[model samples]
Target: MALVASLCNRVIVMYAGRIVEQGPTRAIFKNPQHPYTWSLLRSMPRMDEVGKERLVSIRGVPPDLGKLPTGCKFHPRCRFKVDRCLTEEPPLGEVDPEQLARCWVLMKNVSNPEMQS
Candidate 1:
């Protein structure tokens, strides 16, 4: 994904009618902290020969934005959901010098630090 993004010189990630995360491909992929992006990265199957587990999937389909659910629309499918997610819309937050992620956990500084470089 980062390579694809790098070729374009720009990166944009969308979910549930919103740009959940966006930034330089290297920065975004190397430090993916958004739940949506994390899910995307985790969904990739391992290429090595070993006991690699099957890829994980993001549950449920995206909500119909025409009649989008009230408040945090992703609550139903987000594995890292919290009580705040049920009633509040999360704003995009600066996760690093050049990246932004829209997630309540990230917005409130509640998420774990991104995986080590």
Candidate 2:
């Protein structure tokens, strides 16, 4: 991920063989729109931390690709999942001028306490 952050100009986050989020590397890292992307960023170790901070782990295991979930493949494990997410797969929509995400609950609409720092 450090290598990706340093060497890539763009990033495309995928889940269940589908693109969940895509954008400029900095934009995606600084402000992820999809819940999966947010969870992934949270799980990474930060170099600037002062103490031995435990990384956050995304709960639940990945769904079987052969027998994928009904709606969003990530809904079963997503903390920010809504009723719509369970029944309807969100399209890859524009999050900003340079970002696109596939999620019913965009991170911008939610108050993520972790991102406060």
Candidate 3:
């Protein structure tokens, strides 16, 4: 997944047949807004830190698509989950003009300094 992301000009992260985030590859890599994207990126092994640090990994198994959890399908594995994440489905909102993510965190604040629209 990380390798594919590096080669694409734009990337869309999907979970349970739904888009969780979509944006320019650089923007997504530079500042991932969704918890799932952040976790996926961090979980990849980096050549620069091959021996410097242990590779990170996202905990838990992928959710079953047929019986996805209520609200955000990823809330079950997301370490940064909040109360709303467990019960409210976040809509895909603009993080920037070219970027849209289905996350309450980004929707609540579109003018984030790191990825301003």
lDDT, candidates in the order shown? 0.71, 0.91, 0.78
lDDT tens digits, residue span 1-117, model 1: 635854865577788878888887876666676777777877776567246566678788878779886656777887777888888888887877778888876523444423311
Each prediction's Cα RMSD? 4.3, 2.5, 5.2
Ranking by TM-score: 2, 3, 1
Winner by lDDT between candidate 3 and candidate 1: 3
Error of 1 at 83 (Å): 1.1
Angstrom error at residue 8, model 2: 0.7
The alpha-carbon root-mean-square deviation between model 2 and the true structure, to one decimal in Å, is 2.5
Off by over 4 Å in 2: 50-52, 113-117
Off by over 4 Å in 1: 48-51, 107-117
TM-scores, one per candidate = 0.78, 0.92, 0.82
For candidate 3, lDDT tens digit of each residue in 13-44? 88778999998998888788887787678778
Largest TM-score belongs to which candidate?
A: 2
